[model samples]
Target: MPEGLPLSHAQEALWFLHQLAPDSSAHNTGVAVVIRSAIDLPALHRATDELARRHDLLRSTFAEADGRPVRLVGPDGLAGLEVLDRPGVSDAALRAAVEAALAEPFPLRERGAFRTVLVRRGPQDAVLLIASHHIASDATSHLVLLRDLLRSYEPAAAGGDPTLPPLPGTFDDHVGAERGFLASPRGAETELHWRRVCAGAAPAELPADRPRSAGTPFVGDVCRVEVDPEAAARLRAVAAESGVTEFAYLLGVFQGLLYRSTRQADFLIGCPTTTRLSSKTREVVGNFTNTLVLRANLARGSTFRAAAVSAAEQLRAGVAGIRYPFPLLASRVRLSGGAPLCRLTFNMLNATGSDPLLGLLLDTEHEDRVVPNAGLLLSSLPLPQLGGELDLMVNVRRSADALAVEFRYNANVFERETMRRLAGHFARAIAVAVAGPDSRIATARLWDTAEPARS
Candidate 1:
């Protein structure tokens, strides 16, 4: 085997974050599935080992080489499958067990970044849990791993060969390409574009119910709300009429909420962008996410339409400069000590129509199969509770006729009731913005009465 490979820029940032909070499980990415059929344990184990062998990042550990972090791949890529039998266990107990397993920390320096557990509830019922450190996996990676795991399991279960497709490129090749880009003229231009875009932007100061104290832990909870079919349809229609993507329209509404709450005309909101530019890396399992700090400038007399248009423009510019490293941009802006460059993030996931993961779990096509030829019904388990690293994170999942919105916030910085109210405010903002796109952002109603007082 060859020597260790250098960590990518995204991996390096996650490595430092892990060092800062070694016990924090906020950076762990996980997914679970409830299998309605008796699983072949030995076959599943073999499939898992095959998955690790195929993806080097799954079998790799992070360590410092000459004061810089490097990925060291082991010879055997086995992340042993641990099976637990709990016959007649209550639903609450089963959930608790799965949560505990998901929250288990990974000693990335000594062990591989992947883990798996099987909780057998009965002869024909079980749950499969998969987790990996964010340094080695991401949202897209979870889907890739699941597809490959099941693809490998079917053959192993039948005592036949698993003919998986050849990987187009390895994680090491990605790292090399990233390094090459950073040294190229295009990379320099991209960095310059970001620097100019983020100039004079301050971290958003969302009015929290409680003030954050020094050394406060990064604990968080999620509050979810659903937009009615009528409202969701109106929102899509408005976005289409205004010649902007749904993401831009949603982001505009979020920016308006922040502006009304903080009364700040200019601030920053982080948006995660994928760094998988080439088709070769489409299925690669690693951290290929980069944060793009979108500057939301709501002028004094701007209307919601103007805000949405501005958001659309910024999104275009940001995606064009997505190749610029986030860590380098952070350092260039001297955003070291006080507060993070962006205190809020907004993400939009098209779940109902496009996302392959949700499509598989929900069987959106009514195909009656998660994995072809596998006679098992699979449903996605709720994601395990974990800490958050942001002041506020908003995620919107678009379905056929409705939009499901979830706000994940730091519990220490916000009360449950505050988050509830915030969720309501978000819904109202969307309704108002879509109903009257030209309404002045300042005059848009967020509360029945005056806004709540900031702490």
Candidate 2:
């Protein structure tokens, strides 16, 4: 190990949790890129080594300083690679192997926090697992890593150069730049902005199915729904008519769903925003994500269009301060008991179209079609929930002609059917709201089972 840079704000928060649950892999973010074609082991090994060398953070581990966390970037080499043969195994077994690879905990204080496991079912079928501690990676970072890893593998397979052009700077550069900003007057303004956003905000405690526990089990269960394509198109038309982004309208609809279901007039939800405000940081890999909390007051008789417009405005303002670190914001608010500032988190990827990272990688594929082409399906392993910091998480992705929404809830707090019904309410609410922005939010229909006592 060599001397290294300070951890980014996002990194520090996750590192704190990592320290608290050193045995849990709930914080692990794993990406499995399925390759239906044969894999070149030696070439992949070479590419793996190159990728770790390229992103300093990928080869880094954490340690505690006097009172804070620091990242120790390791010298370049093969980070970690494990190859397993799974010939003739059932699909269940193959899936289990992939999940195990992802759930395996990292030796954060001693070894690099990133590793790759290749589970080969046949010469033409295998799954490539890229697992990294959340502290060292994010959705965007994984995309960068996947793109670079595939690119590196292509040429190495052909015995061509695997070396990538050096990045303008490392993750340390980003940490330094962000720290400088926080120490300036601008940082004070950022804090004030958050103060205004969070004042009088109550945590989103949507009536849970079970008693609230002192310690959140973080056990997660998922419920999925696919927005009817025709309905999605209608909503898109509404957004266009209102001159607001589709995401703005969808977010408003989500808020409306919560309001109609829980009968709460005011509450908060959050969406993760990338902190990479500069092109230079785009290619750098690290935990550069911040959660942006938006407070919504669903006044009686408020039209969906008005809500959409309000949401769009708040979204713009919230993103403007995306550079503000979430951990610091949590502290400034003086929230205690390790309860997350916001209980419901929503993220919309593919807002423009396909996944941003996949879009970038697809473009690269056009230039170099010779890479070991493989069909990649990104999925989350159905492993036991490591535990959750939040009560609910909703992820929305736009597909060919519809929006797919997945609701992940704390199993201890929410029954699987509870989440399932919530998903139904969301889909129905969006469909009804799309009829026109003037549609009353209360008109969104739901079963009596989910209706709440008026708040």
Query: Quick one: best lDDT, which candidate?
Result: 1
Per-residue lDDT tens digits for candidate 1, residues 255-336, read 8888888888888889987888899999889988888989988876888888899999989988988888787788677542
* Cα-based lDDT at residue 142, candidate 1: 82
lDDT of 2 by residue, 76-129 (tens): 763756798999799789989888888888889877578888899888777787
Q: Give TM per candidate.
A: 0.93, 0.91
Look at candidate 1 and give me any clashing residue pairs: none
lDDT of each: 0.81, 0.76
The runs of at least 3 residues in candidate 2 whose Cα sits more than 4 Å from the true structure, single-residue gaps closed, are 1-3, 335-339, 351-387, 448-455
Q: Give the TM-score of candidate 2.
A: 0.91
Deviation from truth (RMSD, Å), model 1:
2.8
**Where does model 1 exceed 4 Å of error?**
335-337, 354-356, 360-373, 385-388, 450-455
Candidate 1: residue 287 Cα off by (Å) = 0.4
Task: Find the 10 residues in a row with the least total lDDT in model 1.
Answer: 364-373
Task: Give per-model CA RMSD.
Answer: 2.8, 4.0
Worst 10 residues of 2 by lDDT: 361-370
